[model samples]
Target chain A: MEEKLLSGAELVIRGLEHLKVSTIFGVPGGAILPAYDPLYDSPIRHILARHEQGSGHMAEGYAQATGELGVVIATSGPGATNLITSLNNALMDSTPLLAITGQVATEAIGNDAFQEAYTVGLTMAATKHNYLITDASEIPQVLLEAKHIATTGRPGPVLVDIPKDILNQKAKWIEPKLVDLPGYKPTLDANPKMIQQAVNLIKDSKKPLLYVGGGIIHSKANIELFDLAQKFNIPVVTTLMGRGAFPDGHELCLGMPGMHGNYTATTSIQNSDLLIAIGVRFDDRVTANPKFFAQNAKVIHADIDPAEIGKVRDAEVPIVGDAKSVIKGLIDKLGDTKLETSNWIQEINEMRESYPLTFTQDEDGPLKVPYVLEELQKMSEDDSIVVSGVGQHQMWISLHWKFTKPNTWLNSGGLGTMGYSLPAAIGAKAAYPDRQVLSLDGDGCFQMTCQELITASTENIPLKIVVFNNGNHGMVRQWQKIFYKNRFSASELTHHTPDYVKLAEAMGAVGLRMEQKSEVKDVFEKMLEINDKPVLVDCVVDPDDMVFPMVPAGGSNDVIILNEEDLKKI
Target chain B: MSERILSVLVEDKPGVLARISSTISRRGFNINSLSVGPTNIDGRSKMTIVTELESVEQVKKQLNKLINVIKIVELDPDNTIESEVLLMKVSINKDSQTSVIEKANLSGAKSVDVGQDYAVFELTGTSKELKKFENLMKPFGIIEMIRGGRIAIQSNL
Candidate 1:
């Protein structure tokens, strides 16, 4: 084989291959034509999305699924601008993504020349780091650095703005030097002394509890956290972000605690003498009326971010380190020091037995959302990834879904951005082809990002989508029903929807809709039969059903509503 | 209460905002509004945090002990040199015009614009100097003031 030099565009394709980026989703334009020309013959498959936002989201999905850095390429101007929302999405969620965009020629930049804008400057606040490649020679190093930055530490989106001329310019390029960031070092070791102190607090306490959050997933510390909890024999309560962190069915696991969390979970936190908060940020949402949260508890927070140690609640034994490493250290120091919490466990069980998540309906009424989630859980594999759109569907999935592994459950917890699912599911499916990626979408949110189905179908990513179609923004409607005296207002959606099955067929995907309770399993089974393409299951759910045990905004977690009888039980 | 400056390096991740902010509140530490930016490193960030407390040293030591924290360097304002920049617009009257411009020159500041009613002066120096100048120019009639959030660099390496 003859050794040959490749152009900048060709080198980009080669670099993506080296980085193991198999998919490139974007919409092409004038400025990036050069790069797209080379993409055709390149091994990297390009997914033409309906919108640039969808492309960024697809890349985000890929990152979250595989734990690899996601990649997206867009052209200049409007093409670049369209990615802002998705970029912010990745930024806010701390997702690992690489967004590469074509820019005008270096000389033409700042002349207000055509589509030339300071893409790097424009994206400064939205990205971890961005580079404006004025020199074609810098592309390789920039690409490598972008990948490195996107995947390292706490993972975020990094952008590389390549000038149009640089992509077109031909030069004898020696490989750029690989530079080590001298200041970049993430600590993994937990100080043994501090770990022992924390363990002592737990062992000495009568009613110690564990408060888990998203940090467990972010740091991949679920196994370690579970082991520590089991060792201490402490009751566990999770924040909204920490749902599925522990097996929901685990004896020690007391569902989500905080505002809008279960009564038992919140009550357990309040009564706890020692709170072992692991990798959890006590957000105000999670600590509604924080003055009352765990009033009896002395917190021992172990988090990687030091700044988070005392932001919301004071920590008696604050261990600032990686959750996995710190928890492991705590376990080692624990060394079989089992604190007897039989009474505490009994109390928690009492709460669970009293105020559990339950809903009632007639045998012939509309489809219930919880049952849909339950059925989906039964149908999906243990390793399947579940993503949800915001609103009622998000709560249903969070409550019903039991996640066993890190990165298996994806939702916009912090930002709570609606219209998140369809695109995110596409991204997840692209990232993990072998694993089933399910998007649990609400009717309102599904419509918002439904256009991405075209991207999913065209790219041939087999995503399993379950839409809880109640024909309304069920959460807002529930709020209106509870707080606003059921005035309805603008919450009820009036727009008629396209027949989803026909719509899915139009996008080259298989769509199944279930109107009755009996039809649910068969429709899901039939959809699963088509493993070659994506499947959309639009289950018509009861518009009247609302998420139970919801703590109204700004209300105490203790102030919950669980139908009259359920309330009496608590 | 004594105050101290601690430079903390953290995993440049998104949720870090929650982690860092919550930590300060938990410790009963009042952060005087911090500034963060990317370091030379690919995925790491440096935060210049200001805290007022008697246990400044304790805060620094505890900060350095954090897992995401790569390093913590304490820069004392009393022992170390520091400066701040302000983009202030001052109202200039014809009667006190020359005096105001002369005062600006003496402070090593430059006036970027001069209008019939007002003028804007950009000053870069210590917070004390900026405050002193702002008081001195009050007689000339003050206009709107816009301050660029502080970016600090330790003078003594």
Candidate 2:
């Protein structure tokens, strides 16, 4: 076959096509102009975000929605620097994200030329791996290797920074070779001895709780996890990142267990005799106080990343393998037997009934945020994808929303980056055009990335955005009210808040504002009916309505306050 | 606190050392001494690090998590041949040259060069022995000195 020459810019698009990337999210600039030129004729759909951060988060959203590699592109210097927060967010959450940034010419890399940034150095610590492609021939291999690294073995964000000169240089077209990374081998199967030990622990315990995490969704092991739970008859409690890992409506589902978790979930783990922690790193939020967390439980951790096995709390039986494989191993070892935990389940149900998630609203008062989420959840389809911005609204969505499917609930759990939902919802909508994609955001979070609404309208993505407008940073204000003598300080946003309804209308989307509780259902139904363009609902919620069942920072799970009266006692 | 010696084999790539050291420091582990150099194998290097063992397990896991690190083995100080090289330039006078040479000889050191005002001596020993030798050379008005960080190899026996 006669060899054909192609520019590095063309190779980039070809590389993405080879990876089956149908869409990308980014904004182009000077150093990245060459790459954008080729993109003009490419089949890949490019989402031009208002900010680099938005693009990075949109990539994350796309990855989370569909278990595939998400790609983001940006220019050098300030543009690449703007992606730091989202990159860190993806890294911390184990999301498979690939960010490609344009750099100055190879000759001007270290000379600090226009739009020049040391992207490799800046992203080294924040990414799973990073590369600086100075040669055009390295483009094919680098992109393929980056995809491999980003999607395999405890996935995380990877970065590739290509200089402008390299993008312009012509190179012979060659097929991408398989990555030969000897040092990058990840353990994918649990050892037989470790599996036997975990099985022994599971069999011996009268009370065993399956603590699941985002790794279930990342590895697409929810079916395996669900099967294991069913076969073993073990109660399951997911972390915030693992919201939809197991069916929330299932009998064994104890809901989320963390700082803002359900009382039953938190207390059940505290009282359980064995904790089968699957694909979860015992983060500070999950383990409010590590010393007291699961004090009565012996841990058997199964995760792909060995480093996370005992990073926070020691695991008695550590199985370093993929979640699906380990769960299958456990099932195989156990045979056709289920552990007996009738008394434990009865006790957990009692706790759940005793301290259920509840809120109150007056006949003629500001709409409660929880009520809005509950109504929204009821109105949405079963497979609807809900992406949330970080704040009290996120907590409310996690607490009140009924997530019946895995990978349906998306939020910034680890980094807790605000301004995540607007662009993320667009990405999710683009990925799954038929599915209902909604962005449940807070007013404070909405203001940060609301500019992306223009992209949503222009791209013809019909994303439903619901802003829980409490006129304040509700989480910070709640913390201040509880911990800082009620001094609001910089938490208030009422003084300079945008008119979201008008703003959404100006951005060429249907806007609806609901101030009264009676109007919420009607307005939400109307918003959901707008299928041609995006819809925004500015819901006026009570500013003082705080997330309850709160476990103060560094406080033990036993110290969780269920309501305002419990808060006073505490 | 327990003192641990960790020997690491890594790809000879730029920023590998920086990545390892920074990761160690970021995790709040104090690197007492670190030495890095090429191994006999091409495109590979060895690093010897001495650090406190308060969070040693976490530190080890973090180190192994780095992509450049090929292998890591914890060497027991009692079962390893630990050695460090020291070079010292001692100020010499008519009365002090003979005494300095005698002291250097007692410490199993050799005079590498002799000058009018000063003399340079080279020594190789365990870290503790080097510390003692440094103290001995300190009284002789040592003008310039540098000690190579500790490196170790497992003893056959």
Candidate 3:
């Protein structure tokens, strides 16, 4: 075959095309304009985001929803800097994301040229791997390597910064091939001896618990996890990142186990003799005080990243591999050695019965966030992709909704980034044009990136966003009420501001308002019925509503405040 | 916290140092000494980091996670062969010149330059020896000093 000569910009487009990238979530700017010219003529659809952060997050949402590589692009300087949060969020959550940024020309670099920034320096800590391409010929190899690094074991965000001159320069096109990475070998197979040790521990354990996290979803190990739980009669508890990794209604499942987790899940972790943590870092939120968390348990942690094994809580039997392989190894080694768990199940069942995830509200009172979430869950499809911004609404949806599939529930679990839902929902919609996507956002979080509604409107992405309007930073206010002697302080928002419906309309989307508690079912149905364009529902709720089943920061999991009745005890 | 030393081999690429340093600082470990230079192998570099960390378990694993980092070895503080080089400029006079030259000669410090009012000397020694020499010159009102951070090779290796 004859050699192909292409410009650096053409190489970038061809590289993404060869990588099977169908859609790009990006914002064009001064330095990146060269690539946009090639992109304008390519078959790949580009969704022009309003902000660089929005572009980054939309890419994350697409990746999380479809388990594919999400691509984002930005220009240098402020554009590159604006992508820091989204990149950080992707790194924290282990999303497979790629960011292509434009930098100043090679000769002009470090000259402090217009729209110039040290993009590689800015994103070094925020991404899994990053490169600043000075040579135009390196584009093909960098793209392949960046994609591999971003999507492989313990997936994360990788960035490639191409100078404007490099983009404009001509280069010989090379076939897609990965450069030699001597230090980048990721362990894909679990050690057989370690798996046998884990099996022996499970066989010896009287009360075992399967503690799962986002790695289960990332590696698609939910089936193996479910099989292990059912065969052994062990209970399962998920982390925030592990929301949909196991069936929410499964008999062995105990929902999330942490600060806002249910009583059954939190208390059970403390009581278990052997906690098999699969694909989870023992985050502080889950382990509050490591001294008191799972005190009786000898943990067997299995994860793809060796660094996560003993970072927070030490694991007696650490199996370093991808989640699917580790769980498969456990199942293969265990055979049919089922342990006795009738009494353990009965104990946890009683905990569930006594302290269920419930809430109280008067029939004619202000709308409640949980009530809206419950109605939304009821009306939505079983496979609907649900997303949330940070704060009370996120917690409420996590506590109340039932997610039965992996990758269906997306949120800023690690970074807890506000303004994540709108752009992320747009990305999710881009991935699944036919499936329903609902961005359930808090008022404070909604106001942060509501501007993305314009992108959704212009792109014709039929995304549905429901704003739980409590007229305050709901979680902050709740914390102040409980921990700060009821002082309002800087936590309050005016009862009426930009008028969300009017704002939605001005942004070219249909908006509806839900005030009466009685209108939740009808309003949710109405919201879901619209399919022509993006829709937003402003739900005014009682500001005092707060998430329960709480473990005060740094407190033991055993010491949970179950409800308002327990609040009086405090 | 007890001090720990980490020896890392990494790809000699642009910004690899920034990436490694940021990783160390983000972990909240206060680095006491750090040195980096090209290794015997082409396209590879070595770095030595000393910090007030009780254990290098997390730090070592985190460093290994970086794609460019080739290898890491935790050196024993007591056993490793480590040295630091120092260059010092000192103010001098007829009264102190003789004592300064005699002491520096005894300590094996080589004079880089000599002048009527000042003198420069280069010294290579272990950190303890360097610290003692620093204290020795402190009394003579040391004008300026540049101390290379500690670099080490494992004794067994």
Candidate 4:
């Protein structure tokens, strides 16, 4: 067979196709034009985003929804720089993303030519690994290796910066080869000793609580986790990122635990005798004050990344392996030995009954965000995806919405990036066209990336964006009110707020506004009925409403504030 | 704070040093000294770093988390043969030349070059011995001095 010559640009597209990349989200510019020209002929569908950041986040949303590697491309300098936040978000959340940026011509790189940037240097810390391809011949191998690195072992964002000259240069395509990474092997199976130690802990503990995180969804270990939880008769408390990992409606579900989490979940963790921390990093949000967090509990931590095993709280039994494999090992090791925890379950249920998540609503007063989310949850199908931006509305969705499937609830749990819900919903909707996609966003968050709605409208992605309009950065305002002598500086957006309904209409989408409780169910139903175009609902929620049961910043989990009186006492 | 030495094996690639150093600094660990060179393995380099042991667990976990880092082994000073190389050009007068050469030879230093005004001597020893040698040479008006960071190998014997 004759060796066919292909340009570096064509090889990039070919590499993506070989990796089975069905879609990519990116924007085109001068330095990246060579690659974009060939993209026109590629089989992969390209989603043109209004901003580079939006494209990066859309890629994340796609990855989060589909459990596939999301790809994003951008030009050099500003284009690459714009992706820093999105990359950092993906890094913190362990989203599988591959970002390709175009550099200036190889000769012009160090000379600071037009649109040139040190993209590799910029993205080094934010990526799992990064590459600067100096030669055209290295394209195919580098791309394949980059994909492998991005999606494997603690999945994260990876960047490949190709110079313009390299993209235009011709190179002979060899058959795809295995990635040459000796230092990058991740342990996929838990060690037998560690698994046995964990099993012993499980068997001995009178009170065992399962603390699950996003890694369960990443590794698709929900079934194994559920099996372990049920067979051992242990109650489970999920982190914010772990919301959909276990069915929220399950009898053993203690709901999300941490800041803005339910009372039962946080208290149960604090009082448990043993904590089986699966796929969780013991983030400060979950741990609150490390000094007092799960102080009574002996931890058995299982994760694929060894770095997370003892990074925060020390684990008595540390298992470094894939979540699914480790959980499977635990299940196999137990061998039908049912641990007794009936009293613990009864105590947890009492806590759940005593401190159930609740809110007050007046018949004619402003609508509550939680009420809207609860109504939305009731209206949507069980498998519908709910993507949320950061703030009070995010907490509301996490608290009120019932997630029955894994990978169906996407949020910026680690980075807490605002304006994530809109573009993310677009990507999720694009990935699963038949499934309903909802963006539970705040007014402040909605304004940040409202421009991406134009892309949603133009691309015909029917995402239902429900703006929880509290007329301010609700979380910041709540914090200021509690901690900063009520000095609401630059937090309120009442006077300068744009009419989201009109804005959504301007972007060629159906716009609806609901200020009363009566309109909530009808508007949500109407929004769901519109399958031809995207819809934005400006839900006027009470501005004074705060996410309760918050463990104040730097405060211990035992110091949770359930109401204004609790704040006053503090 | 207790001082410790860490031997790290890393992929010999561009920007790895920066990656490791930045991660260390960002995590608030002050690196006292770091040295990097190619090892016996192909496409692999060894980095010997000395730092305080206040956050050894965090530092080790963070360093090990990096994809480029192949392995990390903490060398116990009590069980390892650690050495650092130092080169110094000392100002030499007739009065000080004989004394400096005598002290250098006693300290296992070899004269690399001798000039009209100064003589360059190369010394390799433990960090403590090198420090003592440095102090001894300082009185002779050292013109230039450079010391490599410590490197270690396990002593099976």
Query: In terms of docking quality, how is candidate 3 classified?
Result: high
lDDT of 2: 0.90
lDDT of 1 by residue, A134-153 (tens): 66666777788878777765
| Candidate 1 runs further than 4 Å off | A1-5, A171-178, A494-496, A564-570, B1-74, B77-157
- The runs of at least 3 residues in candidate 4 whose Cα sits more than 4 Å from the true structure, single-residue gaps closed, are B91-98, B111-119, B140-143
Q: Supply fnat for every model shown.
A: 0.07, 0.40, 0.80, 0.60
Candidate closer to the true structure by DockQ (higher is better), 1 or 3: 3
- Clashing residue pairs, backbone N/CA/C < 3 A, model 3: none
Q: How much of the true contact map at the interface does candidate 1 reproduce, as a fraction?
A: 0.07
Report model 4's interface C-alpha RMSD after superposition on the true interface residues. Answer: 1.4
Which lDDT tens digits does candidate 2 get at residues B1-157? 3888888999897778878877876778788889999989999999998888876677778888777888889897689988899999999999998998999989999899999879999999988888898899888798999999999888888
Ranking by lDDT: 3, 4, 2, 1
lDDT (10s digit) by residue, model 2, range A170-212: 9976788985675678899889999999999999999999999
Docking class of 2: medium
Lowest lDDT 10-residue stretch of candidate 2 chain A: A493-502
- A330-442 per-residue lDDT for model 3 (tens digits): 88888877689999999999989987888876799998888778878888999999999998888888888999999999999999999999999999999999999999998
Q: TM-score of model 3's chain A, to 2 decimals?
A: 0.99
